[model samples]
Target: MKLSQSQSFVRFWAASTTSYFGTYITSLSLQVLIVANLQGGAADVGWMNASRWLPYVVLGLVAGVMIDRAQRKYVLVLTDLGRGILMALIGLTDLFGTLQMGWLMVMMMGFGILSIFHDAAYQSFVPQLVPKDMLTRANARLEQSAAVAESSGPALAGGLVAWVGAPFTVLVNAAAYGMSGAWMASIQHASKVEAPAGSVRTQVKEGLRWVYRHPYLRSLALNTHAWFFFHSMTGAVLVTFALVELGFNESKVGFALAAAGIGAVAGSFLSTMVGQRLGVGLAMTFSRILYVPALFLIAVAPSVDSFHSPVFPMFVVMSGQFLYGFAMGVEGPLEMGYRQTVTPLSLQGRMNATMRSINRSMIVIGAPLGGLIADTFGFRTSLTLAVAGLAFCAIWFWLSPMRHAKLDENQIEGV
Candidate 1:
């Protein structure tokens, strides 16, 4: 069946795309609000980002178990509504002059909690919406929409922050989430996965065991954990460095980051061809290698003193972001498709949750660690660490079973 002909897919696509736009906007604007408006610093940014992922560390396993047993469609709708309400509350607080950093942190925690469930359900839900043979294509199309949103949302957010302030811009994100919830609610399909007859611990254990025991998945998980850990460190310090050290205004920073979106869009368009030509494992490995140079580029980005043109430093930073984003875009669809294909439908939610929890756990650690390093040693030092870590992860993947693995051969029997 043509993806265009599927009404359910269209509705799901719309909801996901809308949410992605709002998410990117919030990701950029919220940090700006903290640093620019609230007089927060690197530590504050780190803590806030840590708050956003803490829920995954705490509730991810439980959420995964619940998602596997429940109706995923309702899970998606409820989580979207929950996020909308939470973000709206943030906007209201800002409007009423009570938007403290403490309150913002709390709200981010709420968002994280909802995100744990929403992400687990959403990743697991996609396979039910499309045929098995079309999984890669469906994931590519979905990623394409997200890439387009990423390309534009940051630029728009930068403009909004310049014009209306960061707090007011959050209301737009709130409204987008609300609209996305409504779109999700409009889906007519019932996604009822049978609940496994086991205690939560038993279910969780089974999921973890499956992931660790499978050579391909174990390699993927290890590589993902390392990549996220280092990447989170880079992200934690990036905005602060741009704003404080480099003297970049909100709009300039947004536009610089937006360059990644352009590369991501190209990557999404080219993902299938890359996967076909290089094989999924090789494609993913190549992408990981790109992260070394891309991050090093950002780490060594020249300050204003090093360049005559004021825009030269900004150009250097954006070039790094573009390369990094392109690598991620090319890898995203292939990895996700391979993961879903290898796992059984019944365990999909748990698998995604387990992997994500492990990934996010690193964020919980990396965020604060990055902040501490930046505060103690400085941004350049912390970024240098990130560059080294990325190189190590690439080497790790190359040496693991993943280097020679292919998507077609990764599937286990009876999955």
Candidate 2:
């Protein structure tokens, strides 16, 4: 059946798309708020990034186990509501002139905690909405809409921030999350999984063993962990570099980021074709390699002072971000589809959480380190390290069993 024919998936898609827009808006605006409004720098960005993911490190395994035992739909709605409230509170604190770095970090941690449940449930819930064979297409459709949102969200956010200040801009995400929750509440069709019969600690250990023991998953998880760590470091410093070093304002930065969205849209459109032609593993490997050049452009980008027109540097950086986003858009659906298709329904939540907990734990570690490195060594230096790290991931994928990995009916049947 076509995805459009599935009402449940339609609602899920709508909810996800709405949240994506809000997420992008808040992501950019919050960075601006920290740097421009709060007078925070790289270290502060690192702290904020780290705080948000810290819960994933601490509570991730438990949340995954709980999600496996509970209703994923309810989990999604509740977390969305919780996140909405937190976003609103953040906006209110800034409005009241009481928002400090400490307060912001605390709020981010709350967001992260909810995210632990929300994200794990979100990934695990998707297979219930569509056929295993259709997972790639389903994910592609979701990414297409998300790419569109990414393309436009930042530009819209830039205008919102300029008009209403960054704090008020975040209120937009709160409203979006509320709507997402309501839409999710409307999804009535979901396949239920039997709760695993074990203690939470035992279940968590089982989840860990499942991921670490699977050959393809082990490599994928390790490679992804490394990639996220380095990518996050770049993220921690990029906005600061743009605003401070490149001399770009929120508007210009938004436009540059929008290029990523545009590239993502294109990538999403092409993902299925590419995946079919190259096969899943090769497609993923190709996308992984693209990050090397994409980040290299950013690392070597000439500062504004080096160019007579600030537009020149912005153009180069935008080109890089475009490629960066394209690579992500292409690989995301394939990776998620492969993971979901291979794993048993019973282990979905645990598998996702196990990989994500460690993956994001890297963010908790890398974000701060990136910030510190950027602060001490410089943005370019930190970015150079990130580029090298991404290059390493590409090489690993090329040489590892992942390059030959493919989906098989046998594998999907709990092999």
Candidate 3:
């Protein structure tokens, strides 16, 4: 299939890319900032991190309903502007030496709200910009842009924080958000789509009811909920495991993670091909199956015979990450395309949000559970348990309704 492009899509994508890079920078800088200045241990850091994500667990569905009722570009612009202002405030507060834990919590809460809006709007807007046949390619390109930003952006932020102060590094992120807002300001589409014309209460219920009533959505919701639940457990403990248990240096951890970008790029490029060649159902099935092997690598990693075996363990870690990322990349576009095909455009925001909320709730539950498990057992054991959960997710799908479902261009009933 031929690729399609638009100036609007270009403008929006550029904005998105800049904003994504900014988010990575902000995230890295925040961790550095807190660790360098805040007292207490990894638990404290985990609490702060968990708090930031907690809202997604709680408010994702509501955000989606509200956002879907409004113009997505406007929602996007507002979110960018709000975050830019908030980051600027953080920089200013820190510069004045008036930063407090309470203020930081407030800032994080505001940040989380904006994030909810931004993600919901972005997901709902993209399908409108391209044709149905090109959904996989479009999502792939977006994933590639995000991977590039994420893979290298943290190192850049880490360096900036190391040389300058962490607070000043936030300015870079603020500028990126400002640039995103400025570029997005000129978008001409005006988000022609509107909610079903009715009272606000009825419209909201319709969006939720549409998703819950659909068999495909029901299966997807359950599958993704379980998948993210386990994945978040791994995320909760990974950095600490790498740094504390393995005694790896920051640079090593960064380098190991950066190497996975190559896998992400390959997987992103291959996602559409896999879907076309294997059929969307089989492609998704394969991706889900790959996780069992990919995640188990860490559990089964052999201790190196030589201290000179730094490269070998690093290779093991990176290879595992690569496989995990690749599977995710391959699955994303196909899942997105299938979801878009099944739902009406008007329902996109709420449906995405509901699914996302379910997923995030699992993450919320899993991350703390992971931390507690690691605290009680060991990091390696926690990781092994997470792998067990991944295997469970595949089993959930294999025996459930998703195994038999095919991607249909319109709604089909009862499989």
Candidate 4:
């Protein structure tokens, strides 16, 4: 069935888009809160990033097993509700004047813990909603809506933050999550996965082997982990660089960052066509290659001091963000489709959790390290290192066995 015809998919899409919109708001607002309100710096941003993903490193594998054993739809609804309440509490805490850097990080840590279950269940739930043959198209539709949210969410966030302060902006995010949970709960379909007869350790090992032992999955996982580490470093410092070095206010930064969402929207429209024309693996490789020049543009962008008009610098930076967003949009759907199509229903949760756990774990380590480097050296230097590391990822995928793997090969070797 076409994704458009599936009522469950429509509800799922609504839930995802709503959550993504709110999440993007929090993404920018928290940074503004830390930098402008709390007077924190790059290292603080890194620690904040690290704290949010720390749970994935600590409990990701175990979360995978639990998700596989639980009902994914219920997991999705509960996690969304949990996140909504958490965001509301955060907003209230800040309103009361007790939301400090340390406390904020602690709240983010709690948020991350809930996210591990949400994300893992979310990915695994898709195959159950749609047929295998339509995976690419389904993911493309999802990415398109997400891209739209990405495009406008931050711009709105910037406005909201500037107009009402960053603390209150979080309440908007809380409402979005609450709505997302309601949308998710309205889906009519129900799903449950029976637990395998094994200990948790044994189940985790099985997932690890499935990911690391498969020829295509192994190469893809390694390269993706590398890409995430470097990509997250850039993420850790980009807000600071824009605000501090480029002299951009929250509104200007939001407008510039919104360009990425625009690019992603364009890319989502092109994803299935690109995957078909270039082949899934090569299309993914092309996206990775695009990251190099994109980051390079940002790394070499002139500071506001160097340019008489900030427009020139902002334009340059925005161009880089657009290219980066476009690349991600092109790759995201194809990669998710490829993984889900090949993995069995029973193993979907494990496969997603295993890969995502390690991927986010890279965020835990790389975000702080990047922040520290930016603090110790300079933003440009840290960004340059990220560029170099991403270049390695591009090459790794380009030369690895992954480039030759086709999406049509939907069967896992041992499955």
**How many steric overlaps does candidate 4 have?**
0
Off by over 4 Å in 3: 1-4, 90-102, 165-168, 199-201, 299-309, 410-415
Report the candidate with higher lDDT, 1 versus 2: 2
Candidate 2: residue 60 lDDT (0-100): 93
The residue-by-residue lDDT of candidate 4 on 213-299, one tens digit each, is 988999999999998899889989999988998888899889888888988998889999999999989999999999999999999
C-alpha positional error of residue 265 in candidate 4 after TM-score superposition, expressed in Å: 1.0
lDDT by residue (238-310, candidate 1, tens digit) is 9888888777889988888888888889888999899989888999999999989988887888776557555
Give per-residue CA lDDT, model 2, range 124-181, as digits (tens): 9999999999999999999998899989998889888888889889999999999999
TM-score of 3: 0.89
lDDT of 3 by residue, 126-199 (tens): 87777666666777787777777766776677677767877898888988999899878877785667665676
Off by over 4 Å in 1: 305-308, 409-415
| Native-to-model Cα distance after best TM-score fit, residue 68 in candidate 3, in Å | 2.3
Model 4 TM-score, all chains together: 0.98
**Which pairs clash (backbone N, Cα, C closer than 3 Å) in model 3?**
none
- Global Cα RMSD, each model: 1.4, 1.2, 2.9, 1.3
**How far off is residue 373 in model 2, in Å?**
1.0
